[model samples]
Structures are given as C-alpha cells and as structure tokens.
Target: MDKLIKGALQFMQEGFNEHKNLFENLKEEQNPHTLFVGCADSRVLPNLITSTLPGELFVVRNIANIIPPYRIKDEYLASTAAIEYALYALKVQNVVICGHSNCGGCKDINQEKAKLLPNVSKWVSQLDEIKQQVDFTLELNHYEGQHGLRSWMIEKANIINSYNNLLTYPNVRQMVEEKKLSIKAWYFLIQTGEIFEYCEENGHFMPLGEKK
Candidate 1:
C-alpha cells in the first residue's frame, strides 16, 4: 500500500509535472481520434506501444480484450459503456482491437481453465465461438517455427472476433456504414515486439510491414 501511494505521489510530483499542460488541457476536454480496445495485461501499454502521448486514445481494456455483443440492460457493463462514450460522445474515427501473444486469457482458453473462474469462464465463452471459427488444421508450426504459434493464432482470432462483435453495437454499425468509422484488428507479439495486422483476404494475420 505504501508503495502504491508512493507511486501515486511520484506521478503527481514528477510525471504529471513534466506533462502539466497536457493534463490541464485534458481536464477540459479530450478529442482522441481512436478507440483502442486491448487486453488488461500489465505489459500491453497501449499508449507506450503506440508512442501516443496523453489524451490521444480512448481506451477500453478487459481480461482478454473481449467485447460482448451489444445488449440493452440495466446491468453495469464497463466495456460497453466505454465503447458507447467513445463512439457517440468522442466520435472516434478508428477502433483498434489489439490482442497480445502469450495472453493469460488465451492460454486459459487453450487449457480449459474456464471451469475454475466461473464468471470469467462464462464471459470468455464468447471466445469459444471464435475458436470454432479457426481452422485447427493450419500448420502454424511449419510457418512460424512453433515458439508461440498457437498462442499467436488464438490472440489474432480474439482480435478479429472482438472487432466483429464491435460492429454489433448500433452506433458503431451506423457510423461504419456512413464511412464515419473504421475498425482494425491487430496482434502484438510481446516477446519480439512485432505487430501483425489481420489480413482479411488471406484469413490470417501477417506482419504489418509485410502487407502491400
């Protein structure tokens, strides 16, 4: 607890001091152009990864970067509410769904750990649909050399699946149809610091630089 407080104080004293103007302006308004949906993994810092400064991104993070299909209910749904605010209030033009390699959530899905975390298990059940959509026969080992191919595939699939689910939101759907918004799926390999973009044509994720 002391360490946490110390960290907070450090941020207030040093970090915030360095960027006082940015924070002050952000206090008045934020006009981030992108909605970043990413995993709650400690290592996957969206701002750092993108080299984005303060107030550049509207972010929504979850255990596995999951975006549940839109639903109208009285329940408190953090991710959905964030998405709505980003799309409707912020009017973000791009929504990026980013998943990372060696994700605990993806590993859990592969290991069938859902039975232990009942709520998480239930929430991740949506990923099962994505799993079914993947072709198990793909020889990832032959191509990617097998260090973390399976996990990478799972990570990529989750990003694509979440992006598809994002479209289920009425506001998102309407905005996208009007060319007011675009969606991108990305996989970040933490170990190698490589980022891949989902190639819809090839039905696989390829390194971003390899495209075109």
Candidate 2:
C-alpha cells in the first residue's frame, strides 16, 4: 500500500508533469482505438506491453481474460458489458483477446481447484469447453505432469474461444461483418516476454514481429 502511494506520488510529480498535455487532453474525453481484453495477472500490462498511451487502448481485465458469450438476460455481466460499450459506445476499431502461458485460471480448470472457491467455481467453469478439449486430447495421449503441455494448450485455446464468444454479440458480429471492427487472439509467453498474434490465414500464432 505504501509503495503504491509513493509510486502514485512520483507519477503525479514526474510522469504527469512530463505528459501534462496528453493528460489535459484526456481530461476532456477519451477516444481509444483498441479494446484490449486481457488476463488480470499482474504480469500482463496491456499498455506497457503494447507501448500504448493512456488514451490509445480501452482495457478490460478479468480472471483468465474470459469474455462471456453474449446473453441478453445477464444485463450486468462485467466483460460482456465492457465489450458492448467498447464497440457500440466507445467505437473501438479493434478488440484483442490476450491469454498468457501458465495461467492460474487455466491451471485451476485442469486441477479442479475452482471447487475450493465457491464464487470463482462458476466463473471459471466457462473453461469447461477447453477442459473437455484437453481431456479428449489426454485420453488419446496422456502427458507426464499434472498439467504440463495440456494446461498451456488450454490457455491458448481459451483466447480463441473468447474471441469467438465476442462475436456472439449482435453488435459485435454486425461490426465485424461490415469490416468496422476486427478481432485478434494474442498469447503472451510470460517467461520470454514474447507475444504471439493468432493468424487466421494459416490458423497459427506467429510472433509479434512476424504478424504480417
């Protein structure tokens, strides 16, 4: 807490002073170009990772960076609501679903750890589809460790799954079909600080540098 306060003070004094004009402009309103949906993990800093300024990317972070499917009944759903606001309200041009290697939420799904956390149990249960995928893969060929490669695959798969879920929103689907909005799946290799962008052309994730 003390460290965070000190950092805020430093930012107010030094950082804010340096970017006074940017901050002043943002004080009136914000027009971010991208909507970044990423993990709540401290390791993933969306702005720092993308080298974006304060008004460049509107971000939504949650456990495993999950984007629940579009459901009208669930009016106050956090992620879904954020996606709607970013697309229809904020008018962001791009939506990026980012997942990282060795995600705890993915690990929990594989190890049945969510059962211990009642509230989180239902939330992370969204990964059940991926869990089934991993189980089917393991049944064909079992792995060594408890999680091992299966967990990693689940993490990456969740990114694509969330991206698909994003399209379930009527507005999002319309925008995408009309070429008004685009979606991208991203995988961040935490250990190496390397990010991969999913390439729909080849159906594979290529390094950030080779995205073209």
10 residues in a row with least lDDT, candidate 2: 107-116
Clashes in model 1: which pairs? none
Number of the top candidate by lDDT?
2
Global lDDT for candidate 2?
A: 0.87
lDDT of 1 at 19: 91
Q: Identify the runs in model 1 with alpha carbons over 4 angstroms from their true place.
A: 109-116, 135-148
* Error in Å for residue 30 of model 2: 1.0
Error of 2 at 92 (Å): 0.4
Report the C-alpha lDDT of model 2 over 1-212, residue by residue, as the tens digit.
99999999999889999889999899988899999999999999999889988899999999899998888773468888888888888999998899998888776633455456766777888998798878788777856355677888889889988988888888777888899998989999999989999987887889987987
Model 1 C-alpha lDDT per residue in residues 103-130, reported as the tens digit of each score? 8886644345656678877677777766
Question: Distance (Å) between predicted and true CA of 155, model 2?
Answer: 0.3
In order, candidate lDDTs are 0.82, 0.87
